[model samples]
Target: MSDNLARQFLLREDVVFLNHGSFGACPRPVFEAYQGWQLELEREPVEFLGRRLHDLLRAPREALAAELGCGSEDIVGVLNATTGLNIVARSLDLKPGDQILTTDHEYSALEKTWAYVCRKTGAEIVVVKVPMPLTSEAAFTDAIIAGMTERTRVLFLSHITSPTALLFPIENAIAEARRRGIWSVIDGAHTPGHIKLDLEGIGADFYSGNCHKWMMTPKGSAFLHARPEVQGLLDPLVISHGWTAESKAPGAKGAFGNSPFIDEIEIQGTRDPAPWLTVPAAIQFRKDNDWWGVAAHCHALAQDTARQLGELTGLAPLSSPEFCAPQMVAMPIPECDPLVVHTTLFERYGIEIPVFRWQDRCIARLSVQGYNSRPQMDRLIDALSELLELGAPQIAAQG
Candidate 1:
């Protein structure tokens, strides 16, 4: 399975690819599906784009909707999760005293987006720290809930954090937000395929996730899910014909519908919709290959890597194995120039991975997919052991 799956991907054979969490490596089948859609669009631009685009997207969207546990109308395709979150952040009716509460473990790009929005509106961003070596789920929830105040207009959080790679207990946060009548916006970029998502069950006002990452879809495919109640609160990031469509009729049901949230956001002009049209194929790929079994195997590899690294470094993992992502784990590395180790591993060993400093600690994250093998995990473990032996000084010189 490992050898065959590895061959199915377009990733180079020479480099050991361990960074699937960053941007997913598409399988040959899915890539072909993406290209087929593109070819169909090019064959008859007018009929494909003008006549068939909306209908062509329906099946894929419905397939993803079932996986996400939402109705077809609740979800809309976007370029990526960041763009979906941007649409939510920018559309919010924030005022001077309003606050967007989140944790320190969020992706930096979304943090910057909120910062930009705050700069425009006089809102405040309160980032609470969910400390390393996390103690318990209650403690994690308490830390975020403690920051909530009367002015807390929104609760923004990551379902699976970026740098820390911890699967946060967001159900508590979502429940609390509902009780307080505050909006809950969840960034679930790493959650869609990595973890089972029940959007209707979770009940977040706005949810965004990326299919291009863990789902192994072609890049530029993602979704934004808005509950029917709050759909009007969001406007499209790129305003187009959907905005003006309502003028033709009383409520303006454009090509898609009068539901401004899905219609406005989904009908962006002159963009390639090929990646989105291939979602069902990616979903089919997962089912055909038994992705849950693959995820379990990959998870064992991640935990093994973390345990081996922890034994070598004498440092504890950021969270327990239970709280860590099944296929992605973040472990603390011994104090060194993170970039030096990152460079040494890639140049000397032909290993592709990410090592960086988050806050004051140096951390390396490992992402294991179906194609990864035990030997590949050992190669990273062995390379790190060799690199850290020389310390950052020798590693820096070699770099």
Candidate 2:
């Protein structure tokens, strides 16, 4: 069944891809839709961009909003989650001594973004070290709530972390942040199609996610969602024709006749809107294929593979099964050079996976999509066993 689904994707035939979490693989149908949008744009550039663009863009936003359980007016398309997050990070009226509280498990790019923001505004970054082998929601939420102080102005967290691939139980934390009047920003870079989401239920002030990673859209597609009340606070990272003096006034519409949030963030000049436009096709593809069932199978396969790797390496996993992302697992490995492990796996075994060092731990993160099969997983396990020199003898020696 999985093998049948694999044929729909455009990944290389030879390589075993276990890195879908890094950048998602789009199905042929969705890619075709992306190309069609580009062709339409090129054939009549002014007609497409000038006259039909606002309405054309509206459909995808509405589609995505329905999936996320939010109002279409609340979200605007961006190039990626990083771009959306940077807009939020840079827009805040942060002052000196204001602190941005976040976890150590955040993506490195956003970390640099906040660092830059802090440097410019004299705001401090407060990182909470989430306890390892994360077992309970109470422990996770407690650690986050405890870290917040009077000076904390923003509470940022990853819905599903980049490095660890752990699905943080952040609902309680976000609620707590809301009660305390701190802005909550979620890096949901891994969430969109990987897990079920209800953005309104989650109640985050600012949430951003990538359609490219899990929704199977083209690389540049992503979005930032802001609650209606806070929508007025953000300034466009790039001020374009969308900017209007009336947009600053309460109850005033944007230059493009959309909400100020949508017009300001999405109307940046002269860029390919193909990826963003392809989102509906991707969403429809998922619906037609029963992707929820495929996701369940992939999750089981990923966790089983992670267990196999843990047994071979005699190392513990980063989190319990419930806390781990549905289709991605960051399996801990023995002390070794992550670069060499990554290179050897790709060069020698035809397996493509991300092996990286995150703080004190070396991890090989595996992402299983519908296209991946048990045979491919077996190949990954065999490759890791050989490369890490792990076998029955090694297990006995360690024992």
Candidate 3:
């Protein structure tokens, strides 16, 4: 992609940073914009968040909704996708013995959310294992659909997986869920700026994504989009004024549940909404810099990086090129201590990347951004070759 752009990220100067999927690298300009919003919030918290809050949020929400292809009312800013998913998982009146079906590719935090919801209600978590070397989108959809049953009340899938970095054809699965009246809750953590999303077109009951990941905003910026009909199904994690019969929305006096319009969870006492407010600045930054083209270029580089790394390491990829995300790729590494390698790369070679163990594998996930360049990838390749092949010998001898 654009090596110079990637260079703008404030990392240890010597490090060849590749792990954008974990938290995202904010461009210098976007970060400055973020700080500006933070300053604005600090300037007059009451005027910014209390009185003129909705008005300030409205324009940004409209802009984001237009980009995501949904109505502005359908979207609500949140801390992150984890909180967003919790709002949906806890809000929905999942019955005893109800099942929440999800793929093996989900982020661990959300998996815990599903487990928590299951523990509260007598619900079952049906985690479908998607085999590696993914052939096509149909193979994935078919496996997930095959797992569905009468008790399957929910279909929870990731837009782009955390560990595997593959894009699941969740729309097709959701279409089938609609036929069976199953609630679809999509965790789109890696998809906001990485891939094109049409929340309305996907027809998921509830979908949440992070701007801090792919959109390159300050951390703690994310959004949840819920269909109006099912919006009432959400119960904000915190109980507040919206819980009382008198305080309920116009629909019912005894509603006593999630107020979609005024999410009480949002009023969680007090915190910084600076990152959330920076949504417009982040989006505008992308607009000012031809983001779609940046995405396409990043995608190509990700594929290239995956191939180079896979060839160098002699490891089988988690998924085919067609199924994987353009921004990030996960290639399996030797089942060694992930921390050792992660630290080794950073401390020794100055390569900033995520090396973590997941599903009995150590995945090296590299995030391609506009700032990354061919030389950076080459540096990664050379350093990893040294770490895995040449360096392994010496490290073992020392022991």
Candidate 4:
């Protein structure tokens, strides 16, 4: 809300950054905490990794679980949301006639991941096209529910869409999946810090979120949560010590002596657990500064900017304000080369935002964080007004 908050982040002062949805900017205090963990790891690699690693991760995992409204056993830290979802996608037992139903608004990488899994397992991917200029939550839920069939095995959906920047009301969909005895996998990469999340209330079988994106943790800090009943169905992406322990003896268990899910996923060979360990610090940073207040301020700025952009281009917004993200909005830009528009905004105006083609239309998405102010929005609006003239003749005449 304050320009002073911008100085606490590691972002550069010379450029206007409106792409926090892609990769988030971490604050100075959180980064210092991350580095401290790394330093501790380096000082005693064997003692840290071999001895105290489990104990070290316990507190942060508990803290994150408390924040997410889930049990400590339900979640384990991972690199990112994609990695967490990959574990679920790769572990499913898909038959030739089985189908995975999802919307077209999913992230591109996960789209490829599902495609590859289906190709290998002989499963079908039923992609439902969610109508643009979204009317209401009931309509969106109905669109997804229509894609279900007798053979539909899994229902996948994003909590907040990557390109469209729309927040799908997934509670009804997840409840429907439960009623139909289907596995519900939620990709919540953009939800954790941007909006309120209650994993227990949502009741999704599997959910993955990125702390690095919205929670302001260092890169590679993310989490995967699975219901206790479904935990046994998932196999770790990498077969590690936990897997070996289970394989050697039918009833053999790891140090946890409880569920094998956390042990298997959390103890993937010795790498830096520092990123995962700093999650509490990131959560604390948000609490230290009233994050809900910051989110409200950023949402107002984003909505105002999108409204101005739509007025300038004479194009309506993709989704209603209630359905959009708190800090991010996708504005429909005039007909133009998306690549040229993206490059010119960065190279010429020092404004960093994403302008790309989503299906047949070009959209410029703006992301406003706690550090962003009204001046940054005005700068983007001015730069866009000048550059968009190249695509629209009327704008040039007005200028």
Among all candidates shown, the one with the greatest lDDT: 2
Kindly provide the TM-score of model 2 when superposed on the true structure, using C-alpha atoms.
Answer: 0.97
lDDT against the true structure, per candidate, is 0.88, 0.93, 0.81, 0.89
- Summarize candidate 1's per-residue lDDT along 226-318 as a digit string, tens digits: 998888777787877556545334344555653666667778888999999999999999999999988988998899889999999999889
- Per-residue error for 295 in candidate 4, Å, reads 0.6
lDDT of 3 by residue, 1-399 (tens): 555665666665666778889888888887887788778888989888776554565665777898899998788888899989888898888888899998888898998888888889989999898856787778888898999999999999998998888878788899999899999999999899888888999999999999998898889989999898887676777765435544445564322233444445445546777777788888888888898998888888788877887888788888778788888888787656677788899888888888888868888888888777778888888888888886665544543
Query: Whole-model lDDT, candidate 2?
Result: 0.93
Clashing pairs in 1: 246-252
Question: In model 3, which residue pairs have backbone atoms overlapping below 3 Å?
Answer: 3-372, 5-371, 6-371, 15-350, 91-235
What TM-score should be assigned to candidate 3?
0.92
Q: TM-scores of the models, in the given order? A: 0.96, 0.97, 0.92, 0.96
- Regions of candidate 4 where Cα sits further than 4 Å from its true position: 245-252, 255-258, 391-399
lDDT of 4 at 339: 77
Off by over 4 Å in 1: 245-252, 396-399
lDDT of 4 by residue, 1-399 (tens): 676788889998888989999999999999999999999989989999998887787887899999999999899989999999999999988889899999989999999999999989999999999977886999999998998988999999999999999999999999999999999999999988899899999999999999999899999999999998888788889877656545334454654554677888888887899889999999999999999899999999999999998889899888888899889998899877777788878999899999998897889989999988898899999999888865455432432
Residue 55, candidate 1: C-alpha displacement in angstroms: 1.1
Candidate 2 residue-wise lDDT, 1-399, digit = tens = 456799999999989998999999999999999999999999999999988887798988999999999999999999999999999999999999999999999999999999999999999999999998899999999999999999999999999999999999999999999999999999999999999999999999999999999999999999999999999999999999778988879898888899888988888898899999999999999999999999999999999999988888899888889999999999998777787788778988899999988998888999999999999999998888876785334433432
